[model samples]
Target: MMSISSRFAVGIHILSLIEFNKDGISSSEYLAESVNTNPALIRKIIGMLKKAGLVEVHPGIAGTKLARQLSDITLLDVYKAVNVVQKHELFSVHENSNIKCVVGRNIQDTIIPILSTAQSALEKVLENVTIEDIVKDITEKENLDKRHS
Candidate 1:
């Protein structure tokens, strides 16, 4: 199974919660409750988002909130900010395939260029999407859930 990093989703979720709460300084405990994650993990993600300028933390009693408008932020921005694998190929052939096989001998080298192109294409798509898009999606999903209930 291919593994996906949680940073992108988690960061977006945290930001969305902050946005939904309307500038309310959400504590790590509350975010952890919403995310079903440990407070320590929430704190860590918060720190990363804070460094990326995606969110702000008010020290002491008040905790955190988004630093800027959701529309101003893009999915690519969050992906990069949360430290997702950028410019990285989806898969790698760590083991050498049989050198005797014509394709195997050079497949790794040949794949690099293709992989680079694919990665660039993916990033291009990501750049076109923004946090506002995520928020809309989540809100719509929530509404659908409510209607079903």
Candidate 2:
């Protein structure tokens, strides 16, 4: 049932953790603990992030760090890195129900425009959100909650 793979949530987890620490060097093992997943899985996720130019991993001695300013990074940027977008539409409905039914014969044609418009609107909404905005929101909430407690 799941079409798109949402690794953005995971990427955000890694990025948000990085944002919290100014200069704390983190290894894949540390990230693995935070994510409660295998080190190899975390390493793979980190590799993706690196490939997307979101983070820098130092070999030999130093650890991984954010490559770009968090504010400069968009949610879309991170999402695109990990998301496996469905090449085709979510639902098929390709098979013609019955030509004699009249309604069935024309349903696909009738729904195409509606479906296209809906898809465009959805994309526009997604474009409106950025990772910087999300992290800022997270900061505000954490600050507020901490003050209360």
Candidate 3:
């Protein structure tokens, strides 16, 4: 099965980290450490987020920060910012199926609507979830872990 690009998740991680560590500088190196990936990769994704107006990258060690409030930015924003999937391409139908076979000839047509609906459903869910929600969940989990520890 084809998987969505990891860039989407990484983009979310970058934003969450920024908010999670708002007091500290969220330089590419810092984000890279939290993400356990190369700083270059983090910077690249940050660039995408910046382009989408989701983040602002500063010069020198000032690092990066969210361009908008957490409540105003939804998961859908991140999803779109990262360009996780091409426009209207969440689902792909195989092309050039045998036109002679009834199933093959009708397969793409039959699945297009279903696929479109599925994609819309997914986007709807993402749209409803904001970065604040994600950060709150993370903070709650951290508190819970600390209590247990």
Computed on alpha carbons, the lDDT of every model, listed in order, comes to: 0.83, 0.75, 0.91
Task: Compute the lDDT for candidate 2.
Answer: 0.75
Better of 2 and 3 by TM-score: 3
**Superposition error at 121 for model 2 (Å):** 3.0
Tens digit per residue, CA lDDT, model 1, 67-139: 8888998878788888868547565656768999998899888888888888778888989987888889988
lDDT of 2 by residue, 14-132 (tens): 88787776578788788878888887887787788899999998656555788998777776677667655432354455775788888988998888777777765765666677667
Weakest 10 consecutive residues of candidate 3 by summed lDDT: 56-65
- Residue 116 alpha-carbon offset, candidate 3, angstroms: 0.5
TM-score each candidate: 0.78, 0.73, 0.89
Give candidate 3 regions above 4 Å deviation: 59-61, 97-107
Given candidate 1, what's the lDDT at residue 17? 85
Residue range with the least summed lDDT across 10 consecutive positions in model 2: 83-92
Clashes of each: 0, 1, 0
Better of 2 and 3 by lDDT: 3
**Residue range 1-149, candidate 3, lDDT tens digits:** 88989999888889999998999889999999988999999988998999999998865756899999999999999999998887667987889999999999999998999898889899999999999999999999999999999
How would the candidate models be sorted by lDDT, starting from the highest?
3, 1, 2
